[model samples]
Target: MSDSSALTQKLQQQVLELPPESLPDLEKFIEFLRFKFQPRKPKATAKPALDATHAVRLGGLLQGYDFSPELLKEARREMWRKFYVEAE
Candidate 1:
């Protein structure tokens, strides 16, 4: 017999000699070996499409906001003051 087949037979004989109480642990180890050796499937690359519901919710959220440059500058300065000043 081939070396691999001989080794497999020897392992099988040893497993058969093991007590019944140890059989469950042996089964778990065999399962772990199978899982470890199995090839992994590739993950999907395509992103899920965004629906109209998200767009409507976002529009509602920003409906009353001013997006002017001056407003953004004031918001940034306020954030800097709140975090940086307090950190010191």
Candidate 2:
């Protein structure tokens, strides 16, 4: 096996055999090691917020409805009509 892996396994065995009094410090060190090496999840981009006067959050608004692909198009067009149509 790899030298680093062999060393890690040896250290783990030593830690396992240590007295209970030594465990709290080892547990705290493990937490720090986990925080250092754990991969972070990617952050999701927030959806653009609706400026009801500018554009609606069509995806957010339509999330309440069933998966009607055709209706989604119609709802978007209706949203544009409401937001963009001149009162005159």
Q: lDDT winner among the candidates?
A: 1
Question: Residue-wise lDDT of candidate 1 within 33-55, one digit each (tens)?
Answer: 99999998866896667887555
Compute the lDDT of residue 18 as modeled in candidate 2: 100
Per-residue lDDT of 1-88 in model 2, one digit per residue for the tens? 9999999999989988999998999899999999999998866896666686777455686566676899889989998898777653
Candidate with top TM-score is 1
lDDT of each: 0.90, 0.86
- Tell me how many clashing residue pairs each candidate has: 0, 0
Off by over 4 Å in 2: 44-88
TM-scores, one per candidate: 0.49, 0.38
